[model samples]
Target: MTRRIPIIPTAIVLIAAAIMVRLGFWQLDRLAQKQDMLARFTAAEADRTVHPWPRGGIAPLGYTRLQLECRSAGPAQPEAGRSASGQSGWAQVVQCATPEGAKARIVLGWSSQPAPATWQGGAVTGTFVPKGEDVLVYADPPLAGLQPNARPDPRDIPNNHLAYAVQWFLFAAIAVIIYALALRKRLRG
Candidate 1:
């Protein structure tokens, strides 16, 4: 007669399978959310054209109720850096104006890290993006005028969840295959 296998090991396998499947589903859910956000942003951009003023500034970023356009684009602060490719780099978001102008705003989000600040009266050209909950505009970036508090740092770290989800699913598939072969051998006799 063949010795019996312990139940504890079987239990462990079942638990692992459950955990991996759950993780895969979680990643999928996050993916859906990201897609939805992308859709909304696209629609907003399409619905309206960036309206810039020849000699005017836009309403504060938080005040998305207003839409502004760019008459003259400021010096292209070429964003340079490497974080996650496709979305990486940092540059100033300057809206041409003097020190007393209320429209020297920017369309850049926020960053835990700070970038260089240069407030030299230059030029600005970009569309108006309604600030979202995740968007954070720096109110003060060392420079007062000629430089926007928002710096363009395109190196937005991408989500690694999809990779993680794939790994988890692969683990689960392997577990199923190994356990099935073992169980088949045991029962065949």
Candidate 2:
């Protein structure tokens, strides 16, 4: 004797599975877009011309180098950062007064010791990096006696889209298997 799957439950499961699959594809698309952005960032960094710091409240250009004269405003704040060699250590960040009389933070360098003597800030050139809502410049070779910090890495940006896609596909497979098993049990009964 042949048995038929329950129409209502089967239809619901199929619909849900399709939605999950679509979500997986969407994540994949996002992954591609993120990769393209990273490539553009790398290209921008390669240009050596120093761009002036943005005036007013405008956001600084990402991955571009800047040349500016600024002096130490107050004291240096210690923060966590990585060295060029990928070693973790404390970095000295000091508030600097821009030529335009605005305050901006400058990452002097990475040191094993926290709060290294205040760096004599003057004519400075560095790459501007954006961490969340805040943007700070990383002195390429670093000033003071600290080690050089690693260049901003696009690869470091998280791309978990592939994992998310796998999860959605797995959910679809499980739904199909469970429905088939339920149908078999009902037929036996």
Candidate 3:
């Protein structure tokens, strides 16, 4: 009597392996894209050209230095943050109305206490750091007698696609090996 391979189980295993392999390739593509983005950010940091505060989206202006006149400012809100010296502290942030009537968040400075800083608003210059849907302007000289907030650096952003790709590929190889071993054992039995 001849033992035949189980068709359904083999097909399922193959499909799963193929999916994993595809996912690995996708991650590789993401890795390339991330590298390109980081390169652009690094170049932006070296650029000293200060641009007017963006009125709309801030994604493309990330890492670029910007100057804006704060027509008016709201109350300051101190959030947990880090100082430029790598010390744990609170970042004094406030919503300010620009000359263009656009709202912008300014990281006035850092403080050891959570007490909000007093800043009426004035001409501010800083680098644009993209955070989620919003952008934060980390004041270069800081404001309200508070400590300096950490400057934005492209290196701070993590690029883990390579590791993710390796994990997916390993999972695919392991799945194939385990299925082959199980099938061989069944045939012998």
Candidate 4:
């Protein structure tokens, strides 16, 4: 006098829920890793060690002070950014050829206008920032008569793993609840 529970559909639902729960735990692990990385970056920022222009990876050196001579520089291009005082504006960036023959992007300064600045090349000292696959040096002092660009802070990097983990957990719960409701209705009918 009772309908048997569906086998294949129930199996699929449980399996999917298990996967989602596992993913949630994985995100939590990632959150811990991100916290550790941010702590290292904060320490690096506080250290006064100045390194020469890096020809290798920049990830481990982010937020550290670096100095490099720009043997030649391309025309400046203005990118939307914020000034040191937190005012939204333009960032004057230039592609420079380093003495070691490596190319580097330098954020010369900030400006209220989108127009680029006129800078050929010179000795540059600033904070090393790893942006995606590229490396950018944020000038410590305003360059080419432009305003200072906002200093790079590790806090600016987003740590959304906790949010992602919560969303995954919610999805798993929702799936199980929806399946339970459907199964209940089928058995009643």
Using TM-score as the measure, which candidate wins?
4
TM-score, model 2 to reference: 0.76
Which residue pairs collide in model 3, if any? none
lDDT at position 56, candidate 4? 68
What is the alpha-carbon lDDT of model 3 when measured against the actual structure? Answer: 0.90
Could you give me the TM-score of model 1 versus the true structure?
A: 0.47
Better of 2 and 4 by TM-score: 4
Candidate 3 residue-wise lDDT, 84-116, digit = tens: 999998999999988777778999989999989
Candidate 1: tens digits of C-alpha lDDT, residues 1-189: 665665887788889998999999898888777666556555544443443342243343322222233234354343443222233445344454434443444433222244544444433334434344232223222232323334222223255678878988999989978987897787665
lDDT of 2 by residue, 62-142 (tens): 688887677554577888888888888887788788767766678878887775647767766788877777668887668
**In lDDT terms, how accurate is model 1?**
0.48
Which of candidates 1 and 4 reaches a greater TM-score? 4
Off by over 4 Å in 4: 55-60
Which candidate do you rate higher for lDDT, 2 or 4?
4
Point out where model 1 deviates above 4 Å: 49-90, 93-117, 120-164, 179-189
- TM-score of every prediction relative to native: 0.47, 0.76, 0.91, 0.92
The residue pairs found clashing in candidate 4 are none
User: At residue 141, what lDDT does model 4 achieve?
Assistant: 74
Error of 4 at 31 (Å): 0.2
Clash counts for the predictions, in order = 14, 0, 0, 0
